[model samples]
Target: MSTDFTQEQESFATAVAAFCAREAGTREQRDALAEHGQHTHNQGLYDKMAELGWLGATIPEEYGGADGSVVDMCILLEQAAKGMAPIGGIGPTLITGAAYEKFGTASQKGAVLGGIVAGKSYSISMSEPEAGSDVGNLSCKAEKTEGGWLINGQKTWCSNAHFADRILLVARTGRSVAGGVTRQERGEGKHEGLTMFDVPADIDGLNIVGIGTMGGKEVNDLYFSDCLLPEDSVVGVEGQGWAQLMTGLNIERLILAAMMLGTAQRAFDDTLEFITQRKQFGRPVGTFQALRHRVADLATEIECGRLLVYHVARLVDENPTKLFPREASMAKLKLTETAKKVALEGMQMMGGYGYATEFDMEKHVRTTLVSSIYGGTNEIQRDIIGKTYGL
Candidate 1:
């Protein structure tokens, strides 16, 4: 399939790239921002993006969003990744915004979605200490109380929690294992008992402890100690969080795939430039057949990665009801793996220069490595894909 972007998409990407190049391209600036324990220090840049109507690209215009398409968001994300902008946590924020638009009460939508479009941050709290991949086993419990629900549990690996204004928390309200409970008995005719709560970040009992990561962003361990919320906090019908989360997962995987592809393309471009400039044996290194072949292979893989991601995005936009677990998994797995491979090959081709902090390749390596581990590991993606084949 042809992978070229449309004129509008290309224009959007060019705008994002130009913004990044002007505002966040220097090593010193990035390191300084990283040292402050901030994800991205350019709220000015973010605000500019928001002003350009890019922040809430996929949400409806009624909610102060751009009413853009998911493919548009992918284009922006790919551009950010290529620029190595510190906007890694943007996917979760956008996903939470979409979820609010989909399942939130009117008040919830007015508050959360409006704030997100205004460039306020948010996070999704799904992973716990024991519930990394097995989300159903989450120990975070939300029990009904006089007014609403009281949440008491801890969530780990929650990115952007430290700076988020709210968290889209998935808490278990009843006991039900996968395939073992009747949908009607629990509440309705689907996965039930699990509920999504819009918990404020500064709630009385909520605690956020920053955790260091290799990519210079800080994830957090969030403890919800009897954190209480009003009745309006629950998203959609009670006991339908699993299905809701499943719907969001498809978009989440596609976003990550786009980011991975962007990084891969960046790595390839950096390697190409380096090989063409650095001379070895009185000739540019890129003139060698071996390095040329390696670049060709990486370019081909990157093309495949882009196609897989865009195809999945198109499918999600075209048919939201049809389950695409395998397709999503395949896209996530291949893009992440390709990102790592491209980064490694880029570094190897650049030799000593690649290891220098002044060079972008080192940062690319670190960032791409972290990408593989987050948004579900490639190994887990394989397991999901295998199970789809009735394994």
Candidate 2:
């Protein structure tokens, strides 16, 4: 099958590329801004993007969004990654907003979707110290109360929590696993016990503690102690958070893949520029046969990564209900691995300059490493793919 972007999509991609070149590209500027622990996109850039309707690319126009396709969003994300833009804060927001659009109540959509479209940040809080990959084993408890629910637990590795206005939180409310529930009773038994809640950042008992990450992005450890949310806070239905989370994870993986591909492309571009200028043995290093072959291999792998990410995006847009566990896993696995390889190769090609803080390759390496670990590790992704074949 051939992969070609529509004219409109191509135009949008061009616009994003120009925006990144002007606003976010360059290691010194990005590093300086990220040091503040706030979003790297300043108010000026944020407002510009919001005005251009880029912030709400995946949101429906009815809710003040751009009413764009997921492919369009991927395009923007890829460009941002190529520019080395710090879009981590916005990435989860798009995925969570779509989740709310897909499964949240009317009020939930009205409250959450509008804020996100307005350029306010949001994050998803699912990982805990005890439960990173094994989300089913999460111990965060949400006991039903007279008004709403009392949440008491800790969540770690919550990205953008420091600046997020809200979080899409998952907590346990029932006691059943994969195959125990009957067909009629399955919705309740399989998903009935878990619940999703929209929790505001400033809620009285919610505490956010910042954690330093390798890539200079700030993640947080969240503590919820008797934090109370109204009954209306429940996203789709009580005890269905697991199912809802599963429903949106495919999109999440695709988004992560897009971001990795973008970063990898940037690394490749930087490496090309470096080798074209940097001389070794009295000639440009890029002219050497060994390095030229390596560049060719990296280019081919990146094409594979792009195809995998775009294929998953198309599949999701085409069939929102069909499970794409294997495809999503493959995309995440391939893109992150490719990102890591590209960064490493870029570093090797650049030699000492690549390791120096003056060059972006060092930061790119750190960032790519974190991407592999986030959204589930590459090992876990491989395991999921393996399990799909009934291994």
Candidate 3:
């Protein structure tokens, strides 16, 4: 895979960097915008990105978006995260937008995609209390109703749901069919009867409660008790949610990998600044052999992560409709694991300061530590990659 950026891509990166510096250059600014985890973003800043066409980076031009490539979107996310910008909702919004553009009906696309370009964010609800990695087993049922579907179940870890305009929901609609046979007939029927829906957040019978987490108020638990969605809300064909989910997951993993790459870079840059200034034994701490070697290793590792992430981004751009499952999984696994390692090492190197909330190291640690678990656990990624190799 080629790892080089063209002049246009390079210019775009530069512009994003400048935007980050001006908007979210300080920890205090980020804290104020996030409001002690009560919110996932600064709406004002988010609107600015939309107005500047950054939020619509992945959207098609017909929907008032830039029609930019996946690689461009990756660059924008990397810069935003590296600068600690308060645009955490943008990733999910873009991912949700992609799914809508692909499978949504004309009206669904008009509402969701139009909102996305107009600076509205969305949340995705795939993981239920019982279905995280094994999403095919999701029990969130949506029964047929008079005018629509009556959904009744619980969805957990729904990020940005509290403030999002809409949700991309996956629920079980019927029985599973495995290899042209049912599970009761002695076949693997783990991935059937699933359907996708575009649920408005303010719909009656839908309740969202904030879930306190180490990563702040970034996620919530949702209860859908007779949540009524019109028949037109279904994104694609019923009983095809598994295939639809595969498409979204590819982009989701790539977006996460890009964010982690930026996060790793941020942690390394912060640690390097700390060691270069703090003196010990009458010299800068970075001058010590052990500390210097570790820094060098981390820098090299981050560079490798960058190449892997961008290579996957390029593949995605080249084949937008094709699912590069193996490559996307590899990128997600490598970057997330590397991010965790880099953050932990940076914390250890920073010693006391790293453990304090006053410093950004602790925040980076909190964020990167969960990267492995969210976009499907690193173990799952490894399993997927191995299977592609005929393991």
Candidate 4:
């Protein structure tokens, strides 16, 4: 991972890690920052990151961002996760922020991108009850009407929507459009007729209900009932949402991969620290051949994951417009799976202590277990990779 980073990136990583350690180094601090287990995002800590200008690591300088590359973002994300920062909002925020950055009108960019740098979070809603991996099957509809559009549909698994300033809502508009300034963007298929909307989080007729899960209130079900949106709510070319969304996948996958890579490293680090201290059979348990072999194997897997994550990230920075269906999917698949393995193995090694909330290993286990489940599940990632090879 360090091989792909420049000196400035390294310094940036150090600063972010140091800041995270200072702000959220202990469980007590984390509990306070996360609002006593109500949610994982710590707004105070997030605001501090914004003040330090880290949240805009990949945004353009004209918009109050550093204009950093994808690799730079990976560095920021990995260090934050490795330091165990509790800001859950940044992942989704950055994803949606990129959409606006690439396609939003001047006003939209000024509102959303500028808000992002000012510590405001954002979200995107692409999944419905029946359309998780099959995003093209989404039934969420935004129909044209007088003076604007009326959206009426339900979107589930809309992460961070409960606290977002705005949401990038993708809904089905129609198929085989006749004419518009961007009409040619309407490709024929299930992927066609989709449109992107900038839905304000507090807009009337939109309801955000939290869904309790193993990860707490990180996601919500969004109900849009005749949600009236201005004609300008449309983002990018009308009916080109799937193509627009696909443009960001390389960075999206890289971002998730880097974060999970950090989690894997942290899990391994925590396990090693525990085993080195907790003596069994008159010596540190980590000294035993059985545990030592397992640690070695997990360590190797994490390193491999880290390398792949950064390698793919560099590819994105080099080819900003190209689709990396195979490589990006591979990175997401490798790091998420490896991160899960590391946490589970760490749990097994620490025995009862790993299962106890008093230890961070249990938290690692919870987070890593779901890394493979979100951001395009590992199963879907495998399918994408296989399809890339014409399978």
Candidate 5:
């Protein structure tokens, strides 16, 4: 079930694995970092990766990146997740980079990608209290002014916004043209009139409040009262944020898929390790037929997920302009669902140890549990995939 890779890619993955083993070697170390509010890797680890040119893995060489392919990024992310490396910041940064690369102005690209190569993180803010999966329904308004745009709205579930160097803020720019009525002014079928803005995290009137969650402080609610941005803050054309978002969603989903694949493998590996060592009935519990079969099934499923994810990554890399929505959605749906299944099964198999904080299985369970909910819920993914078939 493993994705086929060239010798160079394999070598790179091996190096990443070795790095993880050294930096995030044990569950205790990872837990300690997480306890200190580094839900993903700390800034030091990020800086190290940046120095190694891993942070700009997907950006082109002109922008200080290695000009690597998406497949390369998938390899890096999968290994990071498997080793429990605190590199969760990479995904959001990648998406933000993708957006800037495709639709941003020259200055925007220079600033954002330059920051990435310098180990700065970025996060996109699209989901509002009313938006979420229905991102087009977002009501965050950015009205045109003499100098630039005046932003005022609330965005929830904005992961990394609290610490991100810049927030890729998507807001309503024009009024919906339907029936000559402005949707933002009226509040229905509001898919148009959206624009993307690059706002610095420390901008005036921007307040990021961290939200408590079972997983930790991974997301936040951003309130913008009088946030103003210069004319150059817009990523692309005004009233085209939806198209811009669509352009990056494929990459975003693939990034999540890779993370989930690694997570599922880690859970399975942890469970295997636990069962082989913990004895029962005067023998190893892994010897039980039922448990053995379960492990085999999970292994097979994980391999399948890996193949699908890499396949999609390759397809997107081959045709960046084409929206392989079906393939992208399939990858997200499968890996997320499989990750959840593997974590839950690993927890059940390990019993008390799985539930204990000393073990990583419960943490895996918590993280994977939300995989199906984020990056456009699995339900939304399924609907997108189904629509591809003209269903």
Candidate 6:
């Protein structure tokens, strides 16, 4: 992977950094933008970004977007995250956008992608209480009806749903393959009968409940009780949601990896600043061989992660229609786990001050800890990568 950023890329990063710093540079500014201390999805700021054409980073030109490449999207996200901007909704939104661009009908694209470029957010309800890692095993059934599909099931960890205009929903549409085999009879019939639907967030019989965590009110649990939709709500073909989902993982994982890379850099930079200033026995603590070597090791790891990220990003960019499951998973795993290490190590190095809410290190810890878990756990990513090699 090329380590150089073009002049245009450099300028774009600078612009993003300036925007984040100007908009949410201070603790008070960030707190005010982040509702209830949540560091994700500040709609007010997101609208401002939309106005600036940044929210359309992933959408195509037909939807009033910039038609930017994956690398371009990564640049924007990385810079925003490095600046600690609270635009968490962008990640999930882009992941959802990728699906629509790939599998959505013209109307579906017009509604979702166009809305996204216009500052409207979206979410995906893939995981259930029972289908976190085993997404293929989801049981959220959507039965056929005269009007449309009648969805009835529960979905959990629907990220940013409360702030979204629509949710890219995946549900079961069949119980057997043309009366050939029942799901149980086939064993691990995780992929059959699955379908994707573009559901309005405020649709009747669909409920969105917040799930609170250290990250605040970001994710949600959605309950669908007889949620009726139009026949046109079906995205792409029925019973093909699994394949559509697989196609989008490259984007989803890369989006997350880019953000985490920025976070790791920020944590490392903050720690370096602190150790260089804080005195230990009449000298800067960072001057110590032990601390210096530790810092060096982390910086090296982050550098390696960055290379792997852009490498996979370029691969995806070169062939947007193709999949690089092994490389993308490796990028996701490397950046997320390395970010966790960087954040935790920074906190440990900062001692009491790091734990204090006054500093951003603690927040970095809170954010990075979850990166490895979401976007599929690091263990799952490892499995994906290993399976490619006949493991």
Ranking by lDDT: 6, 4, 5, 3, 2, 1
Error of 6 at 24 (Å): 1.2
What's model 2's overall lDDT? 0.83
Candidate 4 global lDDT: 0.89
Candidate 2 lDDT by residue in tens digits, 1-391: 2358998988998898998777766656665556532344455566677778888887887888878776887898899889776656768887788788988888889877887778787889988897888776677889888989899999999888888888999887667545765432453443346788899989998999988766554688999999998878888878878888888878899889998889999999999999999997999999999999999999999998898888888888888788799999999999999999999999999999999987888877987888888888888999999999999
Q: Give the TM-score of each candidate.
A: 0.92, 0.93, 0.96, 0.95, 0.97, 0.97
TM-score of 2: 0.93
lDDT of 6 by residue, 1-391 (tens): 2557778777888899999999988888888888547658788899999999988977889899998878889998888899888888899999998899888999899988899889998999999988899888788999999989899999999899998899999998876653676764576576877999999999999989999899998899999999999999998899998888999989999999999999999999999999999998999989999889999999999999999888888899899889999999999999999999999999988889999998999999999999989989999999999999999
Q: Which tens-of-lDDT digit does each residue in 1-391 have in candidate 3? A: 2358888988988898888888777777777888854465888988998898888877888888888888888999898889888887888888888888899988888888889889999988899887899877678999988999999999999989988999999888888456786662463576778888989899999999999989877999999998889988888999898888888777999999999999999999999999999898899999999999999899888899899889888887887788887999989999998889999999998899989988989988989998999979999999999999999
Candidate 5 lDDT by residue in tens digits, 162-274:
77999899998877555776655586656678899999999998999999887777899999998889988999988888888898878999999999999999999999999
Check candidate 1 and list the clashing pairs: none
| Deviating ranges (above 4 Å) for candidate 3 | 1-3, 36-38, 176-187
Residue 207, model 1, lDDT:
90
Better of 1 and 2 by TM-score: 2
- Model 2 alpha-carbon drift over 4 Å, by segment: 36-43, 176-192
- Give the Å shift of residue 78 in candidate 6: 0.5
Where does the lowest 10-residue lDDT sum fall in candidate 2? 183-192
TM-score of 4: 0.95
What ordering of candidates by TM-score runs from best to worst?
A: 6, 5, 3, 4, 2, 1
Instruction: Give the clashing pairs for model 6.
Output: none
> 2 or 3, which is superior by lDDT?
3
